[model samples]
Target: MKKRWVLLVIVAFVAVGCAEPLTKTQKGAGIGTAIGAAAGAGLGQAIGRDTESTLIGAGIGAAVGALAGGSIGRYMDNQEATMRNQLAGVESASIQRNADMLAVTFKSDFWFDINSATLKPGAYTELQRVS
Candidate 1:
């Protein structure tokens, strides 16, 4: 109950942009910690039904989740920059980052032969760049 209220207040403040802005890493940590804490508490209650267990679960979850989240965010940032630099002149492919995942989309029209399912000769070059 107390944790929920504190989370709500923090979310409201962030939503309204009243507080100093959060970087992607900071945002990831906050989100991961909140989600992990909730999951941990629920699991602890289901397994142990004890206060000590719940507190321990929450603490462990918060630490692991925050570090993992920050690391993922940083990895995505670096990958996005690399993709943009590597594919600078290639207009047929697009790269997207959603949360911790990266989506690389290539237009078939740019990579495929007309009326055939064969990959164009030049497409290999772009694919090699990506690799």
Candidate 2:
């Protein structure tokens, strides 16, 4: 009976360890892609394209958005490490697993230009290096 109980406990532990954790990055990407696709489709329709064109545009936009988000996540991870080293006063940073990918979120103040969604030249350079 004791041996059976021990085996059950071990099995439970293993199950817990093997369970997949939910990932915010994956969720964000999915939501972002959906929104982007909708917006793309709307724009395509306004421009007098057919349903087929709208769908194609949506697919392309979703792919590009996912790639951009993934790239930005990686860049932020690297930037966090660099900042930690240089500042030495900042909190430790970590990259979380997101499905088969890795992700990191950054403070908006750290990476973006004021009133602009476009990446700064330095940020673009870093992203290029990453790619």
Candidate maximizing TM-score = 1
Model 2 has a clash total of: 0
**How well does candidate 1 score on lDDT at residue 88?**
78
Q: What is the per-residue lDDT of model 1 for residues 36-123, given as tens digits with 9 covering 90 to 100?
A: 8877877777788999889888887888788887877667667778887887777988877776566888999989977998888998
Model 1 TM-score, all chains together: 0.58
**TM-scores for all candidates?**
0.58, 0.40
**Distance (Å) between predicted and true CA of 107, model 2?**
21
Q: How many Å off is the CA of 57 in candidate 1?
A: 6.5
| Tens digits of lDDT, candidate 2, 22-83 | 34455456666776787778777767578887887788778767666656555655665654
TM-score of 2: 0.40
Query: After TM-score superposition, what is the CA distance of residue 128 in candidate 1 from its true location, in Å?
Result: 1.0
What are the lDDT scores of the predictions, listed in order?
Answer: 0.80, 0.62
Window of ten residues with lowest summed lDDT in model 2: 86-95
The C-alpha stretches of model 1 lying farther than 4 A from their native spots are 1-24, 35-61
